[model samples]
Target: MTRSYDEWKAAAAAMEFDGRPVIGGVRVAARSGETIAKTNPATGEVVSQIHACGQEDVDAAVAAARAAYEAGEWSRAGAGFRRERLLAFAGLIEEHADELALFDSLDMGKPVREAAAIDAPGSAALYRFYGEAIEKAEDLIPVTPPGSTALVTREALGVVAVIVAWNYPLEIATWKLAPALAAGNSVVVKPPVEASHSTLLLAELAIRAGIPAGVLNVVTGRGSAVGRSLALHEDVDMLAFTGSTEVAKQLQQYAGQSNMKRLALEAGGKSSNLIFADCDDLRLAAQKAAFGSFYNQGEVCSANSRIFVERSVYPEFLELYAEAARAYAPGDPLDPETGIGALVSEAHADTVWATIERARRDGTIAAGGTRPEINGSRAFIEPTIVTDVPADHEVHTREIFGPVAVVAPFDSEDEAVARANETPYGLAASLWTGSLARAHRVSQRLVAGTVSVNTVDALGFTTPFGGFKQSGFGRDLSVHALENYTDYKTTWMQWG
Candidate 1:
């Protein structure tokens, strides 16, 4: 059953941690005893206090991960044992799905239903999928002439530092941790300070599921401190991050300056949604595009923020799209029925409003460019759609990271393809066309990592997800993600 906003808020306030951060099977406070407040975006209230991790805390977390990796506690464990433990973890997540969903909603301002149905379920599926993959993964195979042989093996990269973004905190963490753990790497998770409660709670759940201490560690602090320290830590063997493109660049620089650790980043996107003249279902296309760009208050990195419509259907498409946008109601995240929740915080919401105002000063506002009213003193922006934005406008090129989309008109297939690939980011794109040949051609020309031919933002667990160019390199889900956390070793031997 879904709880009311007041009930959810009350439950969150009543929830409490044991007054210490979980590290190496022990609950201990930071030596400095500082704490960071976790705020509820829906109400602008402090939901909980997380450890204010510093350089020393980061060092301790890294040491714990290093020790676990060096001892072969996670990496050297047999595939069957790892699989069993991971499956158990997945089950635990499912068992506590309600609490986890509530925590995520309260902490991150994502809709409760989505947190329960999509984010949490997707995370659990990742663990279960990786667990199964580990069981079937093959060991070293010999290849050579009859007299000589070579062995190819995969080894875990020790001490992975997983830095997750505030949006989809728990889901992103699982995307990095599940595969890394399954592939035998210890992980030190640095969750965004804005939404660290769910991640910290997940770490506790890991302990309950029998995961060894130090195999997983949670450090909460601002990116400049804890996050920067982890990126530059010498003991960290790999860095898996999902955030903005600018931060990813900084992380790359830090890694280069440090131990040159392996870097896997899934960064920002100015994803496009194309509606061809031949599309038979204009309403469906409009609905999908609306949700793709506006869902999660448009906080998704892979949001379809750019919409290109064929000139023939442009007029009709705009009408339908506007209706769909109006249907999305922005309200408190704790309201399970709310379609659109608050932005992550007041500062973020102000930035989004400022971006809209800037866009208006530079161009014309086609649709919503205002804030919505809510009972709580938190950040909440309406679903906005802008037209007449030039191709070079900041709104078109930059990642607004809000429920704001820009619509542009295209004369032909070639023009649509060109406009779609014009942005600096190439993370994901969607095409709406009835012709199979056009779909194939346009998808090939569009320079994104994931393309949905008839849909928008339809990413699956088995498929690899990442981006090209400035969107950052390295895949995030499936076997590809596992390979990113491990290094391949080849051995050649000759006998008399």
Candidate 2:
């Protein structure tokens, strides 16, 4: 149930937040005794002081994760044991769903309604999905030559470090944590300094759910500090990251420079949404286009920021799309009725506004391109749509990571696919069409990890989620996600 604005305000007023780093299963002050103020983007108020972890803090978290792994309390536990505990963790998350939702909503200015209804429940569902998958996993016994036997098994990698973006704090963290923990790997999580409250709360809940002490630790700080340290730490066995493409490259280089630890990265994306003239439901398509480009204020990695409409329907679709986009006007994140919330920070809003200004010079603003002050904070940007964007314009090629989309007309299906594939990112794509053959043909040719026939950014726990090219490799969901945390082992015996 969605709470009233006043109720949400009262809850925020009553809530007390602690942003200290969680090391060895307990909240601890940073050794450096330094902290960064976490400002609420919605209200321009300081929410709490988050720890600024340095190298020493990263070392301590890694040591604790390693100790937990070597202790074999969680690492050596049976699949059933892990499954049961993970289920309990999932239950705990559901029990505290409101608190988790509030944490992300307050920390990062996500709409409380969406954060409560989508992210929190979705996070719990991921835990449950991965927990159920644990017991279903089966070892392989390959055929062997006479007098010989071979057994293949999957084993957990020790001390995995997870770094997630601030956009979808608890959800993204859970995407990595559920599989890593279910696979029996002790983990150290590095949440973005912009939004670490929810992650800290998640770790506390993990402990309460009977997870082994030190099994899951959260280090909250700037990415350059805690994040980079985790990437370079020699003790870390594996690292999973969700962030910018440039950061992914840096993490890869850091891994090479240090321990050469295993890395699974889900990086940046400028996904495309192609609307063919044959689409039967233009109005529905336009609504989805708005949602694709504006959901989560377009802070999503796979947001369809590039829209290619068929020339025949371009004018009509553009108008409908603009009308749809206007529905996402930014408002108080705490208000359940608000569809759009503030950006992650004033700094991020400035960056987006700069992009909008550039887009106005090079492209036509079809929908929204304004930032209105809310609660004395100008961190709220309207859902913006830009049309007539030059093919080579910066807004057309670069990722703004905001509720801004660029629209253009394509003459043919081939042209649409070609232009869409021209991007450096291959994370996701969406194409609206009525012909089954064209759908299959175009979907096959799209240079994206996931292609949606009539939807945008289609994903589920049952399907693998990842990307190609600079969007980085390694899957995030489905049974394939387990591969991120586990390594295969083989045992052979021969008697002659």
Candidate 3:
């Protein structure tokens, strides 16, 4: 709120961005000497040339991470020491919040207002939460036979490789990095090609906050090169990734082909929001439905892109939802008052527009679906709502990964649940009902990882965030996420 749109735009025009790879706690050039043009989604301008990593760069990063893990500088450090350093890292993130916010806005077209207010602060809070939680991890002593002792302790899995999606670049990275680092594991992060600025800056900040050299490294490039190398590298003990389901499956195959490295994946979703006629407030439900579907330009993994309304409320809810969806008009990312920002790239915007066009052919366009020109870039698509979609249509099952909502009507509670669970993804689902019994009943039957009653994409650091079935296994947040970066070791002693 401090900066006007003009002021923010001016700051971006004069901003100096460093897109060099960060390895072994320092800014390093790619061994391949290749680079990719980093484009600003808002203005369609080449902002910087980011170093593109090859297999050689991946090897260097892996070797450095393995060395750091085996050297006992961070992995074997005392919990209190790691905790203090992580807390300091969190503080530095807060200190440089504005700069990092600008990185997200300019790098991937995230609204600077949203990035600064939510993503940056949220990333800092995650680090702080994990920093405080690390020391609280307790070893277990189990009851054993007489004259025998057994103790189980949690230990780090060395050299964890993280590959994150472009949307919410810093926040999603933190979701994996905080718990991995908190568990005392050395990490190598491969940021999405479309948005690497914030992640590179984050790695630099980790070094500044006293994380040891080689403990955290960032390799920036296409997923085909850098991500594939990490996934197949025998030296990597684990891979934590958040991206497409297709990519997640590929990573799984690569893991099996190599060393069978552990994989923690939070993949794609075609989540649904079920609105019943008996809801306490239909208007509130419609607003939340629109927010859940269009927030972050609807690039979220757990976005409620599919909405199922009861037959009695379908007509009324669809209108309210369409009205709410149209409120999120695409605008300049640096604008403090703008709710919706540009898509990550013109290519991605085109893809989303194509999806909208298909939806129009397959169904009815309830609200916005036009690709409006913004800031001289063709990457802006207004929030769209599609209604009267068939049950077996591809639009209902596919992950659009854009600000497009599909609405359908169901007659009974059983019918609503059935339609909602018809998708291949089981990442998240939400329901709105006035009856407490109905809420619990429908929630129990929803085949999703997280079920929010009368809410959308409900999550926190205290709760585990992940999916079921093809949405990918393993949790990301909470104490469970720390476990993903670690394993348990049990020791037994017998003496008579």
Error of 1 at 199 (Å): 1.0
Instruction: Give the least accurate 10-residue stretch of model 2, judged by summed lDDT.
Output: 387-396
Taking the tens digit of each residue's C-alpha lDDT, what string does model 2 give over 92-147?
99988989888899999999889889899999999999999988999999999999
What's each prediction's TM-score? 0.97, 0.99, 0.99
Q: Where does model 1 exceed 4 Å of error?
A: 1-10, 17-20, 140-142
lDDT of candidate 3 over 66-167, digit per residue (tens): 999999989999989999999999999999888889998898998999999899999999998999999998999999999999999999999999998999
Top-scoring candidate (lDDT): 2
lDDT of 3: 0.92
Q: Rank the candidates by TM-score, best first.
A: 2, 3, 1
lDDT of 1 by residue, 241-274 (tens): 9999999999999999999999999999999999
Model 2 regions more than 4 Å off: none
Span of 10 residues, lowest total lDDT, candidate 1: 16-25
Q: Evaluate all candidate structures by whole-model CA lDDT and list the values in order.
A: 0.86, 0.93, 0.92
CA RMSD per model (angstroms): 1.6, 0.8, 0.9
